[model samples]
Target: MAWGLAEFDAERRGKKEGYSAGLSDGISQGIQQGISQGAQQKAIETAKNMLTFGDSIEKISQVTGLSEEEIKSLIK
Candidate 1:
């Protein structure tokens, strides 16, 4: 019947829209996480270089935004 076809079509459209929205949100979150991880990695590398140059843990922490504990761990 016409009414049954219309209902089926509406349901299908709703599912497609939901899937698209979810995919978009997932992509955005993935990008944000990747950026955060990259920044953290860069900070760690900078801290290591500073350590090699005899920088104090507190100084490295201040400059790199990493904790003193993290800088100390890098010595190992």
Candidate 2:
């Protein structure tokens, strides 16, 4: 009976560890995806603002770290 209880405890601990790992991975992925999306949005907005300021697409790309083609596509 004692041995059976010990084996059950070990299995429970393993499951807990697996759950914690999966949760951590999910949270990390969500945070990174949010950050990447935010950066892309900011870049696009910056390009649009530069357009309003009469800057060329190339200049916007330089300032925002976006490609010229991306800036042009945003403008359209």
Candidate 3:
């Protein structure tokens, strides 16, 4: 009876560890996705601000550190 209980405990511990690993991976992935999305949004807003400030596309590219093609795409 004691051996059976020990085996059950070990199985339960293994399941808990698997669940913990999965949760950690999910949280990390979600955080990375959020950060990437935030950066894209910030870039778009910076481009818009530069346009409002009367800067040319080249100037906007220089100021925002975005590529010329990206700035042009934003303008469209």
**Sort by TM-score, best first: what order?**
1, 2, 3
RMSD of 1: 1.9
Best by the TM-score measure:
1
Candidate lDDT (C-alpha), each: 0.96, 0.90, 0.87
**TM-scores for all candidates?**
0.93, 0.88, 0.74
Pairs in clash, predicted candidate 2: none
lDDT (Cα, tens digit) per residue for candidate 2, span 1-76: 4568889999999999999999999999999999999999999998898899999877888889999888878767
- Model 1 residue-pair collision total: 0
lDDT of 1: 0.96
**Global Cα RMSD, each model:** 1.9, 2.3, 2.9
Candidate 1 per-residue lDDT over residues 1-76, each given as its tens digit: 4669889999999999999999999999999999999999999999999999999899999999999988889999
Off by over 4 Å in 1: 1-3
Candidate achieving higher lDDT, 1 or 2:
1
Number of the candidate with higher TM-score, 1 or 3: 1
